[model samples]
Structures are given as C-alpha cells and as structure tokens.
Target: MNSSFSIGIPSGRNSSACGYCSPPGERSQGESSYQVAGFDAVQLTCQTYQGMIDRGWRRSGTWCYKPDLRASCCPQYTIRLDALQFKPSKSQRKVLNRWNRYVLEGEPDDAAASSQKSRSGKSSTEFVLPIAVHASEISNLSDESPTHRFEVTLEPSTFTEEKFTLYKKYQSTIHNDHKNSSAGFKRFLVESPLKDEPIPYPQTPPPYLPRQYGSYHQLYRIDGKLMAMAVLDILPTCVSSVYFMYDIDWEDHSLGKLSAMREVSLAREIHEAGVDNMLYLYMGFYIHSCPKMKYKGDYSPSFLADPETYEWFPLESCRPSLDTFRYACFSHPSHSSDEVITDEPDYLQVPLSSDDEKEIRMLVASGKRNFVVSLSESPYWQYDEIQRECLPCIHGLGIDLSKGVIFKI
Candidate 1:
C-alpha cells in the first residue's frame, strides 16, 4: 500500500517522567522512569502505522512513541489476539446474551429508562438478572431471532457533543480522572492521522447499519441509545483498538472484555468477507507489573511483540521471562541481558541502500515534512561512517535531523 501521509523525523534523544511508574518514594530500583523521543505527525498510512505498532510503537492521537522498555521500571509488551480462533468465555457470552435480550424486549418506559440515567445525564439500560432472563427467553427465541441486540456501527471519528459527554462521564466515574477536558478528549480520540480507506467488501449489513471506514468509532447501541464506544484503526491486516469507554452504570456488563471480544468478532467477519490479513485484534500494551493492565493477557491465544527482535511470541511463553525480569526481551533466551539490537550504533553499517537514499531524496525534494522507513537500528553518526554521508543530503533538504522518527528493531 502506498502511503499518502508524511511524518516528521525527531532528532536527538528525549525522555519524560513515566506516567505508570513514577511517584515520590515509591519507585523501584530498576523501574523505567521515562519515555524516549518519538514522532509527532498529523497523519500516517495504515501500513506505516501497522509497522510502527509491530515494532512496539503506539500513538496517542497523532503522537507516535515507544516506551523505553529497557530503562523503565514497568515494561509494557504489545499484545494482540488471533480473532479467527476466538471463543468467548462463559461470562463474555452472558454479557452478549443479556444485551441481545434487552434489544429484543423493546425499550422500557421513559420513567424506568430515565431512572437509569447517570448524574451526567447519560442513559444506561441495566440488565438485572440477565442470566435468569436468558434461560427463560432462550426457549421462545427462534433460530432466526437476532442473538445480538446491540448494533455495532463504524463511522470515521469526529468531534461530537454526545461522544464528549460520554468520555467525560467515563473518565470521572471510572478512573476518577477529574482532569479530563473536551479539548483533551478531542486531541486524544477524535483526531486521527490515518487516512480513510474503507475495505472494498460488499455491504450486506442488516437494514439501518452504517458502513465502516478506516479510523472509526465502533459504537454499541441498544435500541438506538449509545451505551459504549471503541476508538479503532481498521487497517488492511488488523483492527487496532486505540481506546474504550463506557457508561459506568453498566460496569456489571464487563463492557471492556465484551468490547474486545466484539472486535475479534469484527475482525473475523471482515476476513470471512474476503478481506485478506484482517485476522488479528491488537489489544495494545500489556503491563505485567501493573495489575490493572494485566487483564490484557486474559484473552487467550494472544501474542506479545518482542521489544528487541520485533518478532512475536505467545504470551504463555513470554510470561516466564517477565516473571523473572521486569523487562523481557524475547529475542534473547533470558530477559536479563541489557544488550539488544536497538543499542547497536553501527547496526546499519552500509550506506543507506540506493533505493532508500533515492526515496529519501525524493521525499526531501517534495518538501514532505514526514516520511516512513523500516528502521532496524537507530541512525547515529557516531557508529556508522556511512550515516555521515547522508547527513549532507538531509541537511541540504532542510530536514531537521534532531527531531525525526527512528524505530529500533
């Protein structure tokens, strides 16, 4: 896939206080305390984004970065699930059945519905005794009856009062995040750099279902009322989950877990409809040291990307390493070694390949502020003399070498 978006390159190394592991007097001896320099761009292609994610990089809005895994007190491993083989757990299935029942039963009276709304004025239709009702309702439900009541719709993310309202409520009620603001919410979730590239599959959804695009909000609505939403990047190969927020009143429904399962199901549906390589659902980083984040591994048949080699290993195989060392480099047998490929300055010994050099020249000539490359090692002049040769062209093009994107393989 050709990339239509350009990215600025970050020059020089930069780091900041860690959000997950930084607190006065509570920091561990070897805990990673910072995030290294990363790319800040307005746009990127799905292919480029996928490559970035595979190499352990993530984006918050448009800023792309990778954690300093080696130096951080709490290391984060990128985790993804094979959607084609996913089988929902008993609890997960119950959540789905419950939501389906509510959809089929029709909307309750305004009085009952209004009572369920939160203080933020968001309506939440609770499913009390959903399991018991499932047993009673299952006998009467026909084979053709919709097993899922909620309709999952995908549309390109845009700023909206409804979404902002839901986000404010979720952050304040669930995480006690009082600092959330509409501007921050728009910057974090509404803004996306990836271009819209809807899959060319036929539209066969039930009547009233909206068509999907590239970067979107996967909305779960029951009887036309929004209950949950997931920010996702639907790429050619996989559907990357960026963030999820729901009404706090529906906490018993386990919407987080159900959202994940639904994403996997969506991946399968896309692949079955002949969209190639759409088989995995990226669940983002799994922080072993963070109890709240450890739940990412609960979804079985998952794989973790090795921070050193950029290869993936099964979560089960990677757990032992994480158990012994806070940061596990799966490229090595033991996670204790600090030596990894990213640390090598001369890793790219040869001069930039002719093709890459030409492409860089073209990008520079075109005045594209940002570009993408498969960086296996950091480009530094100290180790590789060949890198020095390219410096002239880079400088001549007025590209800021100090601030650029560098992916360590």
Candidate 2:
C-alpha cells in the first residue's frame, strides 16, 4: 500500500486566508479541515511551508504549525496496489534474471538491462539491476517475476563506526559530481548546539528526513550485509521517504524498488495487523520536466493532491489541463475538494536588459508576446539545457530564457 497526503501550499487568495497566520492560530468556521478518507483514495497538496518556517511558524513532526488555523489536520492515506497485476518491461526482466543468477547461483550478472545477447550468447558472471537509477518511480514494481518469500525485520541502525564507513561508501558511490565537501556534509548533520559532545552521524541520524515529518530512522539489511537503508519521517497518517539509497553494486537486485516495495508491504502488513490510518507513500514530487521523475504518477489509480480543494481526482481525468494554471488547481487535492479549479496570473512579464531589448522589440513587433528568454533578472542564466531540451517537446512547458522567468502558461 502506498498513497499521498496534502501539505497545504497557501495561495495569496483572499485576505482573510491570511488571518490563519496569527499567533496561537485560530480556525474559522466554514473552513474545511484538510482531511480525506481511506488509504485507497488518498491525495495531498504542497504548501509553502519552507517559506512559512521563516515567518515563525513551527514544525511538529511533518505538520507545520499555523498559529491560527487549528482546524487543519495533516491529511494522509495508504493505497492498495494490485501488485500481482503489474508487468515488468523486457529490460526489467533482464535485470531481475541477472540478479537472480548472481545472488542465488553465484553466476556472473549482465551489466546492462537491454538484452543484445552477450558476446558469447551465454550468460556471464557480471550482474547488475536492469533498471536505471533515474527510471520512473512507477516502474519500480513488477509482477513479471515469480514472487519469493523474503524476511522482514525492524531494527535501529547500530550506528557503529563500521556502519558509518558504509554510509560514507554509499555517499561516495553516488556522488560522482563531488559537490559537497567533507566539512559541509559534516556541518549539515549538526545544526543545533550540543553540550559537551556532538551528535553522532550514522548513529543518531538527522531529526527529520528532508521532506517528511516525525523523528525516526531505521536501517534495513538483507542476509548479513547492509544493502539498503531509509531515513524516513513517519507522520500521523503517512510515511514520507526522506532519503533512500541502495548499493549500486546491487543494481541488478533492484534494491531500490525492493526498499519501497518492502515499505509498502510493511505498511499493508502493519495495517492489517493493527496500525491506524497508515496509508499513502509520500515519494516526493513527480516532475515531468525530469523524465526520470514522471514515474511517480504511474502507480494507479492515483490523483494529484489538488492545491485548492484538498481533494483527489483521477490522474487520467486531468490530462487536458496538465499544462495550464488550471492544472495546478486540478492537480491539488485542496482545490479539487472545493471544486475550485480556477486560475489567476501566476507570473508577471518584466523587461529584460538593454542589450536584449532589441531582440524583445523584434519579437514584439511580430506580435509574439511569447519570447523564450529573460522572464526574470538573474546575474547568471539558469535552466538553459532544460530550455533546449524542452523546446522540442510537443507539450513543452514554455521556457522564459531571457530573465530566467517561467510561468505556467
């Protein structure tokens, strides 16, 4: 079972909506509480909570504290997947077979998911997960392979020096870019003041998973080796996957999918056995601009958490409006619940630099209000590659390259 929950992203709509900002917040009548029913039909919205945090709003686990809006409840749910109905692609099967041979038979695994027939036309010893790490999140599940019994256990990470070493190894394996310094990573782990000693990394774990709520961390190991680990923030009704990483060496094993699948299984098992309202997997956003990211929406039957009405609508039903401001409202559970799928000007057109003014004039003279650049003023331009790639997309989201401005047109 996996589902989504809404995190209210406030729209600068009615002024009284701002009244929810008062300290020790108050909730007005007629304002609906953002609640949903059953794990099967869960949906949620995104809130500008990060921005709100700066304005003195506090965080209680994953739920943000609104001084005045006491009526708001952190909505969450779990959705049942007909896992047996899933079908893995040809590439997926190759990955699975390779891992099966390697892990069970000690044979060489195929490095690639695509089957072009090995040079010898015989299976080799090298094996890897058939899927790419960047593949769609929805593709993680597969009913194509026969199900096998696996063990499940819950234990806190030992936080030993050895585990810490493994953690570093995992980080090094994935950080091909080497963007962070050893010091910077260390500083990030310890943001609060400690007395005589510092909080241990890979031992105590961080307070919250980057995007989830609640304070819990656990390590999952298979056989005798540590293969996968998750640092999640468990909320009242959902579990948000904060940071999930698996050994790249176990790529053929589909450990990333296994981690998520296991989590879902655990949630189902837990719910069946006793836990209350534990539905939905907040796997984070599914950005279509990032192809590797769109898979999150494939886990049917799903609906985007509308930002307006706090309701859930079928994803297939909203295909027509995905590119418009209407999509924002329709995709949001909040707006959907209230049946408020309307839009206002979300962006403003500003002038570009003098150097670019001539180009702007030419575009304007041709009655082309749609220029591809300088939507905003930034010292250095960003998203150039994104613009180039998106330009060819038939449903491409317009790229305002001039001022680095992008409005959902």
Candidate 3:
C-alpha cells in the first residue's frame, strides 16, 4: 500500500477557552484565545504523520493541525517516552499487577487491595468489575490457571456498537461530556486517513490477534472482556497515542496510567520484533500550565520538543524554562519571545526552482494574495518551501500571510 497523503491549507481561526491559564469565570489577562491552523488530510502516510507529530502537529480524524506555539496561552509541547528504557515504578507495577490479576483470576489481588486502602483510604471493592461477557468472553472459571490468559489485540479504526457504547459511557461519566454523539465519537476516534499496513511480528501472535499497521484500536482484555481501548497510530519511527478511553466504572484501576504504560510496552515489543526505529511512545501534547496535564511529565526520562528548533530536550531541562513563561522556546537565549515576524527562518527555506519562482511571481502579480499552495508533489521540500519561498514571496507582495493564507505542503 502506498502510504501517501494530502493536506488542505490551514484555516479556522478561533479563541481558546483557556482552560489552563484562566479558571471558569475569570477572563484571561493575556490573550484569551489562541489561533489554530488546520489541514484536512487524505490518506496520510505513517512516515508523514510521524514527521508531523515530531514537529508539534496533531490530528482530529483527518483534520491535522498545530497550535500557534508562539501565541497560544497554553503552548503545548510534544512529549514522548523512550519505550526501551522504560522502568515501571512501584505504583505503576501495582496498577499493572492489579489489572492482570483481576482479569486472569476474576478478582483483585489481596496485596493490591491492602495497598489501595493504605494509599487512597478506599477499598478495592470500589473498583467495578466487568458487567457481562459478550462474544469475546472473559470468564471467572478456569480448569488450570493459564500463564498468559490476558490478551491485547490491535484492529483498524472502525465504528462498532460496543466501542461507541463504551465511548458514550466514558464521556458522560469521566468528562461529563454528554453532548458528544455517536457521529462525533466516530469522527474523532474511529475514522483515520492512514492506510492499513499491518507490520508482521517475528513471533507467533495470539490466534485472535488482528495485527494491522497504520492506525489501530488496541483492545486490552482479560478472560475475554474488553476492559480498555487505546487509539494509536503505528508508524515507522514510533507509536503515536491519539486518544484513550475506558470503562469509567473501572476508575479505581487507574486505567489512564496503565494504558500509557501498556503503550510503552507495546513499543518495546514492536522494536524487539525488528522495527528498530519504533522505540518511542508519543503521549501527545503536554501543557505545563495545566495542572490536570502535569501527570504526563511523571513518565520520567521523557523528552519535549522545542517549538522553535523542533529538537527534543529532556523534560527536566525544559521545566525551568516553562516555569518562567507560558511559551518557552528552548533553542533561543530568551527562552520566551512573543513577537511575530513575517519573514521565514533560514532552516525553513527551500531552494525554489525556476518554475516555482515564476508561478509565485504570477500569483503575486495577479493579486491572488490569499491562498494555500499544495506541496504534496514535493515532500522533501514542502516544509521548507512553505516557510522560505511561499511566506517571503507573499510578504514581499504586501500580503500579510499570517492573517489567513496557509501553504499546505
């Protein structure tokens, strides 16, 4: 399968709710809402998507976008974990063991129960068990305890009644997101632009495993009950976590942290199976200003992408910079610069061919000031061309491109 994709020019500018900087009733002292640039993607390749993620871009279904890092009140950092080096902490280990024991043995471990009470003053009884077994049955009964009864399977993004039902429950219970409809859930989670290309594993997988590549819904089951699901993009370089939702009733299990840890484990397994570059588990954006998002930093030995240079820096090294300013550009001496410049940086410049220059000149002469140039044909130079030639040429023509024009490369 050809892993090729196209992107629409960035559009849709709006104010952010400022959940991090401002509370519910207060107005933001700084710029209240940030501008967002979006692109409608068609059949985005794994490699291309990976590159975009590294460059601080994300997607909602086929719509790809990057927050204006320089201007946003809560500048998001692209955070990723080195799966191979991951070591579970005592707490993390407890979560894993708790889940495994419950699924395999149909009940929480005695030690885990004690630990839960000591830590949170809550009993393990608070943790809700699976309601009913479906076609994928996970029964409590067993003749002999199998060593590895619990299983995880990866399937392509698809809308299923079960998944939709679970999503509805998760939204209403966890986020209080009652307005989310099945259509919205499908658009946000099930639909993807990447082609299905399952990377074969070296070792034999479970009989029920649906090992397809590209984007997948990784279902974690014990006995056979679908306990949790993780939406991920399996790319050449890394596994990108798009979104994760689980049975909200199982809140006591700490499924969020467990899902992350599981993703890292998946990455490790993929690497060991021969995908050498598949060593990182991308945890999406980390906003320092958001107290709720601080847990993303707990995954130690992780790195955050510097917005300016697009270089990865240790999370610890970047924390000091983030502490002083809302937006931190680690590559620059000032660390925080809010000024907007029309000129493109040198690093983003691409050498323009004669045809390219003539086309640009024609567009400028004709007064076609607002438009996005599709650079799908020139994958290697797309990013550079957009920043270098496209922006500069438009700016020289007295057209401030930042107002709306987006060069979709």
**Candidate 1 local lDDT, residue 106:** 45
Global lDDT of each candidate: 0.63, 0.35, 0.64
lDDT (10s digit) by residue, model 1, range 191-296: 8877665565665653322244467887766545677899998877788999999998778667897788777777777777767678799998888877778888
- Single out the weakest 10-residue window by summed lDDT for candidate 3: 127-136
Off by over 4 Å in 2: 1-102, 107-153, 156-163, 177-215, 323-327, 331-409
Candidate with the larger TM-score of 1 and 3: 3
What lDDT, from 0 to 1, does candidate 1 have? 0.63
Candidate 1 — which residues are off by over 4 angstroms? 1-5, 9-12, 22-27, 30-32, 102-149, 200-213, 335-409
**Cα error of candidate 2 at position 158, Å:** 7.3
After superposing all C-alphas onto the true structure, candidate 1 shows an RMSD in angstroms of 9.1
Model 2 lDDT, residue 384, Cα: 49
Candidate 2: TM-score? 0.42
- For candidate 1, give the lDDT of residue 155: 78
How far out, in Å, is residue 310 in model 2? Answer: 2.5
